[model samples]
Each structure stands twice: as structure tokens, then as C-alpha cells.
Target chain A: MRDASRAASGRKVCLLTGAAGILGATFCRRWRHEYDICAVYRGGRLQVPTQEEWFIDPLSPHAALRENDNPVFAVKSNLREPAEVQRVVDLALARFGRIDLVVNAAVHVDRDRLTSLASSSDLLDETFAVNATLPIQLAAIVCRQFWQHSRQDNQAWGRNVINLSSMASLGVVAGVGLSAYSASKAALNMLTAHLAAELAPIGVRANVLAPTSFPQLVPTSLVADTVVDLDRSDLTGCIVQLDENGLRETPSAPSALHF
Target chain B: MTMPEPRTLQAVNDLQPLLQARRWRWRATPFPHIVAENVFVPDVQEELARDFRTLYDQRTTAGYNTQHDFLGTSLISTQCGSLEVFISPAWYALFTRLFGINEPGFLTAGVHRHRPGSRNGFPHNDIFPERLDVGPGRGDVLRFGGPVAGKSVRAVAILYYLNNGPWAPGDGGETSLYWDWKDGVDTPVDSVPPRDNTLFAFSCNPHSYHSFRTNRKRRDSVISFVYRGVDDYVQLWGDEGLRQYAEYGRHHA
Candidate 1:
């Protein structure tokens, strides 16, 4: 860690996953001025402005991620492991002293249809683990931390968790082979709703931004602007779709059919 | 003011054979519905479109609440001069001849406007079997309890599109006929584009599920529902009609 004392300097912190991805990098660049960002990347290095200090392994004793005067702190950690996930939260708190926002942008897509059955059980499990389960786990940890920290400080500010989702969650896109991808995204949407309901009393809002299409990919600036819009609004438990037309709130998922 | 013009009368007459030919095909589908183009004379269509636009602008300026959820668009109930055409005897005769009804009781009529980003209406039947007692002076509503409920009566729903301009081919806002509700196989079996001067109609049965796609552009239409019995008045207007009648009672007394 560079300096725990430096982290105490007041600045709203944003913990962004998949910071190396297109959307994630764009968000970091645009939001760096307004927020102290803890950019967590798993695979490659992100080219955003960052502090000189780097923490190789979050689990190790010497692993102390710190944010100096620089607005971004790049922490490389595998989010699949529970220990590593917890470490990212710890690093954010230790570096920035507070996490005001968490953007779960990491997604895994497996293009296998139910009819083909070519996707192995292991692949399906990994897909769900990365796409849905890990995000939920990260959200639970952040919510708990916010609750504990607010109780300690006796002050509550608006906190937010924006889950990057796709329209595949609503239904299977034609010829997209989205059996696993759709199921996982649908699970993420449900998770977002549950989080919104559970965390409302604590001033933490959760929502999903699902884009309708990725033709040439959705503009990163649009996604960033939507995130800022959702963060500033009181809207929660909503799955807003970003398309060429504009943003629209999708209807809630139907209740399960009982036999 | 008077009966429909000769050309408008002829237009109504021309619709009978086309509707008859498709009656069996529409009824055989999961939901019963028919879409007919050129339902009105060109001049009459232009007049209705102009009146609809004027009324829509006036109502929207007066701050009418948008019904984006169930009705699939914003509605304006205030009558306009163009609506007189629907109440004309020629219209009644056309409906009577087309559907083979002895006497058609006009339930209600209204105009609706759907702007962009206002799509995705869940599938639903227009009439239900539930009854609402509207106290004294107001009649009770007897909902359509499907075919099996011997006490139930049928109603006809008609939607006349007035989107009098060119639209993109893939642009949505088409009226969709579905087999069932949201949770069922939601793929629409038939989708009727909101083309100018086109009309879509169906009998309000249990399986007569219909909804509209979100309007990619502006779409305007006039909807009229007709039933065989006066009981449907309560179904169409609901509590608002009762309230109006109560106000009338207060004023007259």
C-alpha cells in the first residue's frame, strides 16, 4: 500500500471490474475526473492513468493496493476465487477509504444452443460462475461493507451497483446460440432486482443496463452516460435497455409456472 | 351531419366480401383477427387523419395521462368532429353486414397516440367475465366469460390506423395478435402494420389476445368497441362512466 493516510483524503471511489475492456476503459477515462477509481483487471493491463504502486497478488500479506495522488489504482486479481474477490473489496477500502460505486462489467459468453448440447457441463458451470455468480458475490460483499461503514460513520450517501447486462436475458436472439449466455444474463437481472429490494433501505441502488444489440458494439460513451444517469436517479429494480433508439425499461420477468 | 357519402358507402360495401373470405382463416388461428387495408375512402381517411392530429395535439397540450402499460398508448376520449363518421348509420350497417349481427350496440370509441419508446404491451383479452355493479341509475357490467360461460356475450374490437406517412420497413408499432399471455409462447402469429387507412378487428374472446409493439415512430389510431348488449358500457368505461353518471345525477337533481 502507498499510504493508508492518503486514502483518507475524501473522494468518492468507483470500483470497476474488467477495466481493460472497451466499455470499462471508456468509463474509467470519462469518470476519473469526478471519482477515485479502483480499476480491477484480470487478464491484460489497462492504459488508464494509474498510481505507480501495483499489487500483484491480493491474497499475499504484502498485497496492499493504495491510491496516491493519482485518481486510478490498477489492481490485478482473479475474480473467480472468493478470496480474491474479497481482497479486491479490501484493497478498494484500504486504498480509497470508501467505495461509492461498483460496476460489474465482466461477462462470459458461450455460444452453444440447447439443441447442439456441445457445451460441456464444465463450460456451463464456468459461464454461470463468471457471468452471474461472481457478480452476485461481489454485490453482496459491497452491500455488506456499505452497511457496516454507514453504521460506523452514522452517515449514509447514495451508493450504486450497475450490472452490465445484455438483451439476451429477455429472450433468445435469433441465431445467436445463446442458451448459456441468455440463462446467465437472466440470472443477473434477477440478482439485480433482489439486490435493489434488499439494499433500498440502506441508500444503495442497484440496476441493470442491457443493450439490445452489439452491432459494431454499443458506443462506450453512451454506456457511460447511462451509468451516470442511473447513478443520479432514484430508479432501482429496473432493467433498462440501451439501443439505437434509446433507453427503455423492460417489464419484470414473469413468475415461474407451478405444476 | 347526414349519412355517409356515396363513395364512403361504396367503400364500406367493398369490405364485406374481403372480410367474409378471411373469416374462417382468422377464426382458425389461435387468436381471431383480420386486417383490412383501404377500409375508408381516400378523402374520408385524410379528413379523419387531420381531425385525429388536431385532437391529439389539443389533448396532449391539456395534459392527458398516458396509458403506456395496458392500453399500449396514450388515449384521448373527448369526441372530435371526425368521430361522427363512426357513429353514422352506414358504419353500423357495414359492421352488421360484415359480422352478421342483428343489432350492434356501440360500447365506446376513443383515439390513441403512441410515440417512440412506448412499445411492448403484454398480451391480454379485451373483455373478462368479472361483473361490476354500478349501484342505482348506473347499469351493471357483465364481462365476456369466454365461450363456455353460457351467460357471456361477445364484443367486437376495431382499430383504425391513421399513421398517414411513410414508415421504415423494420420500424415497429404493429398491432400483434398472440395465442396467449406474456408467459406463453409470445411469438405473434399475425402482425398488422399501422398503415394509413387500414383497419384491424376481432371478436373479444378468451383467446383473442392482442398487443402492440413499442412505437419506433409516432403512430395514431381510433379504436371502437361494439357489443350486442348495453351491459358492455360498464365494461368499457368502468368507474369513470359511473362517476360521470353520478355527477349528472347531482347536476339534474
Candidate 2:
């Protein structure tokens, strides 16, 4: 239920999860235009940023486009906590009033052996909680905001959600030690597909940025590429790739000879 | 701890007349490629011919696939008689010429070893990804491409074939260069076949896509070396960091 008014006006609002990490920071710094950004990260830990601080400044890359002079709010709250995700959503809605693009790049890694034949029983539990559950929780919060905004202002734009997936999710992990990490990423990919399907009518888009691991380990190049790719997706479900950070945002016309 | 004999270099120089007549390494201006006919010395070739049994045994003993890529491929190594091996000063000068790093910030003069296989190696890139702190220009478009920050980097690869060995016709194990794609088989400029001790050298990058057509015969090995990061220009190939991307392909090779 996009607010016909905003859609007609063409003002796009965006939000990004995991704003502090290396990749998130890239989004916070590089992608600053095309839409109003609401850069979201679990940064504050205990104290979430106030509405003006978190939603308006938006931690996105371009400082000039910020609502105020320096529009960036580092809100620290875990997506694993449903309530926390909701709170941030509420603040974002209250401040600038909409979230058009959501890049959910936050993920927790397990240092232990996941595919270890001798591991403990809690492997599945921990993996799902961080990777799958966190995205779900964030989605619940965003969807709620989508509905609430539609009801309140009667406005919306084609909002998108991009989740960071992993290479291990597709095939076996190369390193025998990366089983738990790999399985969790795989689960995250499926979650992204499921949410994209359910959150369509609201003019909200959900997608995944499945990236391969480079020696750097963090991903800003990947997210930046996804932003470029998402511009073209017309259907309800889309799974884009962040090939070595060469993501783009073109609509449906096969992209140029990307590296 | 023995030093590689210096006469091996003379043997390579002597073969240059016949090699130049082949007119290899005559294609590209910046990164031209070719297979030098002579890869190893007589002594090195002999060592390579007899090294596989030891190499294969090492793999099973380690309980891993860390073994070699093929069956009968042999090996040859060279050293300047120093344990602390590094790039040569001359190659460093080459990096300064190739990349616009201006300053002599790179280390050159490196070498490597290669062992050919009876099978084709997967298509891959040799460079590693580096981190750059990107800043948005104007609105929100962070155009990322080329050099970032102050870290200038350059990598030069030299492959010295230790064994020319014999090759059957249509064995198809030639190094293929992919200039761009067409219909299906990427348009190739060069596809050097495996011959006796041969040498290959080139700069590496996204545009430098290369792979062996096929190695469906005896194994092969090359003595390889790299002179890397001798300049300021670095590559931001932008292959995103997604391991299992849904639509886009793998990033690092």
C-alpha cells in the first residue's frame, strides 16, 4: 500500500541495517543519492538514537543530502531482538516518515565448527538466531512500518530490502572449518526469498545480495553493487549478486559488461 | 640450500632467436603474452621428470587434496642463493613503467614455479581484494573503480616451464586469453600450447582473463614467480564479497 502521494511526488526514502561494519560503512559513505537514506545499524547497543538523530541524519554516504547538515544517526540495537528492530522502525517513521530502501547487511559469525562431527547440539540454534531470525525480525519491523505509514499518511514508494548472503550458502564451504558459518548464510538466503514474496503489495521490495568471500572478509563493494542492481528488478522475487562488489542498479536491461 | 646455476639464464637467451621467429608476445601493448620455448635447463628437466612419485606421496601422507593438480607433471625451482627471496630491482622498474604509481612504492623482481596437469584448471583471477574507504561524491553515487587511497599495487607473473615434454595433437592444453565474449567461446587472441620448457609473463587484472583450454594428457609444471605491488595504481574489480550470490557469479578466483 504505497502512499499514492509520495509515489506521485517521487521522494524515495532508504534504510540500511548494519551501518557500522565495514560494508555497511561503505553504504554509509558511498551511496548517498537517488533516494533519502535511513542508515540503520545496531550501533548504540543499549541506547537507541532519538528520532531526529537516528532517522534524519541516516548515516548514509552523502552528507549534503542529510535532512540537517550532518544527517547520520548511529542507533545501536540488536536485530535479534524483535522489540529493538521495531523501536528503530518507529523512530525512522516518526522522524523523516518513510523507509524506501532497506539494506540488511548485518550478520554475526560463529567461530566454532558448524559441520564438525563432534560439535555440540546448539549449532542450528545459534546459526538460525543470528542469520535467519535477525532478518525476520527486521522484516517484521519494516512491514509494520509499511502498514503504519500507509494508514497514517497514505503514502509510500517502491521500498526495497537487500540482505547480504554468502558464497557457502550455495555450495559446500571450501574450508572444512566453515560449516556452521556456511549453513547459516544458506538459511539467510532462503529467508530473503521468502520475505521478498510476502512484502510486495506494500510497494516494498525484499532481495538478497549473496556475496563471495574475498580476503577482506567485510563487504561494502557488494552492497554498493546490489544498490545498482536493484534498480531493475520488477518482479516480486529477485536474487541479485554482489560479484566481487560489482553490483549495479539498472532495471531489467541486461547490465553492461560488469567486471 | 644449493644455488640455482647461473648458466640456465644463458640457455634461455640462446633459445631467443628461434622464439622470436615464432613471433609470440606480439599482440597487446601493455600486457602482451607468449610462451617461451625453453622453460628449464637440462638438469632441471631431469629433476622434474623424476619428481612426481615424491610429490604424489606427499599428498596422501598429508590426508588432504593438497597434492599436485595432475599425475606425471614434474617441477624445477630457482633461487638467488638467498633464503629471503624477493623481487628483482629490474622488475620493480617495470612496475613503475606499467602502473602510474609515479613513486617507487612497489617491490619487484619475483619468480614462481608451475607444474602442469593432465586436466584443465578452473578459470580464475590471481590478485587479492583490498579494502578502500569509499566516500560519496555529490549526492549518493559512490563510483568505485581504479585506485583507492594511497596504496599503489602492481603484480607481474613469470612462468618458467621446467618440462617441455611431449604433447599429442589436439591435446588442447593451451593457455587461452579471453579478450571479450562472443556467441559462446570467448574471443581469444592467444592460446599458447604446452611445449618443452616455456616461459610466460604478463600483468594481471580483470581484463586479463586467461585459462588453459584443456590438460587432458600428461601433467606439466612451471617455475613461477611474482613481482607484485610495485606501483600506486590498484584494482577495485568490484566483484562483491558474496560467496553464494543468487544471480551474480563468484568474485575472487
Candidate 3:
């Protein structure tokens, strides 16, 4: 739930999941001033700077905003449960008045890659619940809210959903233990595509950003930048892959002209 | 091995008028790509088609997927007398100018012969990130050795259909470009028919995804690659992007 004391009027509302994760945290810190962030982190609250190295800078991106007036509403919720998802949505709406952007950045990675598929069914199930299914459910609820609050004034602002996926989902990035993670992300890609097509008439946009997440290979900031760019652009139902080769639209359409 | 005859260069020069007249259709969707038809004069096209068999001694089976197979060989490795027309300076300039490749790179050409039932080529950009490690002077039966890392990045890929044989839409073997991938190769968004005197080419990048399906007829085309420096690719994609390519190439190479 948002801290009622903070004043974040006029700014767009961003419901960001995986708020504590590397990508999520970076996004929050970088864009704190731009949007009224509803930062959703499960497991625990955002930890202060400690002895251990953290994925994001100890000073949250919203620290300046925090010193003056807080715009980030940190919420803790396990999105797998329907009630929790609804509670978060309801809380966000009550606090921020409206939600303009949804960034489903939370993910479940199966660390135990050695286990066989038959034995790791539980892990696979959990992976799908968090990575793939939750995004669909949350988007459905959010879109319903948008439809209910349809006004020509707010419609012009346009709502957007950006789902963070991995390069593994394309099956081009091969690794032994990535089957479950890959499958779930692939499902997310298809769902987002369908959602984009279906929601286009309603002035809502949905897109998937599949970036190579190896920190050493592709920087985390590049991924964040791509997401922001995707949000700013009119591209919907597009699965944009960012890597060493830069941004490329998957299943790229060939352009040839013949006289 | 026989050296290419001087007249082949002359023939390539004579096609300049037709090449200039060609209206290339370019598109940035999916990725940067271009296509132009009626690329060659009829006489030159017929002559190249008739001599296609001379470019190879014996075609070798190649391709990744089990369901797909085709006979392919490097024309330069064969040193056929007619190979000069493709590797000639005029031809090389046309490719570089069309693709806007600024760097100096070697031009290598190969022929892929796909027969009926040997359909469905896998989608790939033809840039092998792992090939950069293989040092020069290790020229194989497929390609000539160039400077270090020059053999690694394929800057551009151009396919000129040599068979000048009658072709139709249903005949298949159209080099298809895709918009996305599913379990296997999904239906291509656009397909270039393997028609005579037609030229299909694109700048080889990570997003230049393309494949082909050979359904009924024997599909034959001279596939040429412009091998640029690793630095050029690195400059565009960054070191990490190259590393990612290398990593992906390790698993799939």
C-alpha cells in the first residue's frame, strides 16, 4: 500500500514487480522521478546498505525523492495467489488513483539444473506460476480496471505493459538447466503477443523484452534502457531481443522490393 | 585447379547497365534487408546456369537439422574458370555499395543444391561468432584463409539464383524471412522465389533471420558471403554482444 503521507500527483503510476531484483531495482532507482512507482518485492522489504555487495546501489534511486517527498510505494506480495494480486492492484489504485504502466520483471529460476524433468515437476510448476501465469493474470485484472475507468481524457495517456523475458525463451541460447526457465519465458512471450493484439483497440500496449541476462555479456542497464524505450515507442506485440548485436525484432520480416 | 578466365570479368562488367537499372526494395523491419530482381542479362544468366555443374567436383551433404539436407560446396575452393564473374572487383563493389559495408573484406561464394524432399532450411543469419577464433592460414576445402578474424564475421550474404530454370510459387525453395519462431520454423512473413536472374541479399546481422523450403524442384543458387573484420562487428554489437555470440556459438556451432 502507498504511504498516504507522500505526495506524487500528476506523475504516471508504474506497478513494478521484482522490485528488489537487479533489473527491477535499477529501474526503480533510475526512473523514480519520472513515475509514481508501486514497487512490489516479495521475500522482504528493500534492505538498506550492508556489508555484502548488492545488485543495485545502496542508495535507492528514489532517495532524493524520499528526502523531499516519497514517490515509491514499496509493497510486498507473492503474486501467485489471486487474492494477493488483487490486493496489490486495489492498493495501487487506492494510493496512486490509477495505474499507467505494468512491468512484470519478477522471475523464478530453477537453480537445481541437475535434476531430471520427472523429479523436478514441482520446480517447473513454481517456475511457470511466477514467470508466466502471474503476468497473464495481473494483466487481465489491470485491463479490466482500465475498461471500467474508460474516459477519453485518460485514454489519450495510453496504458502499457512491458514483460521482461530472457534470451533463453527463444531456444537459441542453449544451456543444460534452462529448460524450465526457457519454457516459461516462451509461454510469457506468446501470452504478451496475444494480449497486445487483443488490447490494441482499447489503447493499451503490451510488449516483451528478451535480453541476454548474463551480466558479464549484456549489461543490466541496457536491458532497462530497452524496456523504457519500448514503453515510449508505439511498438506493441513486439518481442525485441537486445544483445551484443543490439535490438532486433524476432521473427524479423524480410523486406524485399521487386520491379 | 583452373584459374578463372579473363572474359568472365568482362561479362560481369557488361551487366553494369542492368545492375544500375535495378530498383532495390529495402526494408528495416525484422532487420535491415534488400531484394532486387532481374539482376543479370539473359545471356550471362544462361551461361552461368549451364556451367553451374563445373563449379564443383562432387557436392557434399550439409545442413544442421536431420529433416533438412542439401549438397553444398565453396565455388572458390573449386577454382572453376567461371568463378571469376562473382569474385570480380565490379561484382564485389556492387555488394559492398548496396549493403553500405565500408571495411575491406574478402568475398567467398558457395553453391547450395537442394532437391525435392530436401526442403526446410533452418533460419540463421550465417554469422558464426565462434569462427573468429580460428586463425588465418587454416583455409579449408570450403574457403580461402584471410587475415586474422576476417573469416569470423560474415558482413553480408547475397544469393543469385543460377538455375534460370522455370520456377513458380508452388515450386517452393523460396528463401523465406520470418517474424518469429515457434517449436520449429514458423511460416515466413516474406519469401523470395528461386527465380532465374533474381538476386536476394541482406546485411548479415543478428536479426537477419532467414531460411528456405525446397518442395518440388531442384533449387540451386550461388551463395556469396562478404567476410569483414571482427573489429567491424565488435564496433557495432560491442564486446559483450560478441561474447554472447561466442557463447551461443559454442553450444550451437
Best lDDT among the predictions, by candidate number: 3
Q: What CAPRI class is candidate 1?
A: incorrect
Off by over 4 Å in 3: A1-10, A44-70, A113-115, A148-155, A251-259, B1-253
lDDT of 3 at A189: 90
Worst 10 residues of 3 chain B by lDDT: B136-145
Put down candidate 2 lDDT per residue, A1-259, tens digits, no spaces. Answer: 1122233355456666777776776665555545555666664221122223221111111233332333445565666664777787887777667666667777777666645446665766767677777776777777775643562232235456677767667788665566776787777767766675566545555666667664365355655655545633443354454455464332212321110
Q: What is the TM-score of chain A in candidate 1?
A: 0.80
Task: List candidate 2 segments past 4 Å from native.
Answer: A1-11, A33-35, A43-70, A115-122, A148-156, A214-219, A244-259, B1-253
All candidates: DockQ: 0.00, 0.01, 0.01
Could you estimate the TM-score for every candidate?
A: 0.43, 0.40, 0.43
DockQ of 2: 0.01
What pairs collide in candidate 1? B119-B214
Residue A25's lDDT within candidate 3 is: 79
Q: How many backbone clashes does candidate 2 have?
A: 71
**Please, what's the RMSD in Å of model 1?**
25.1
lDDT of 1 by residue, A106-187 (tens): 8787776565556558657878898888887888887677554463231234467889888778876777567788888999
**Residue B146 Cα positional deviation in candidate 1, in Å, after optimal superposition:** 99
Clash-forming residue pairs, model 3 = A29-A61, A244-B241, A251-B178, A251-B179, A251-B180, A252-B30
lDDT of 3 by residue, B108-201 (tens): 7777778786757666656664354334454321223345443357888888886738897688888888653321444665677888778777
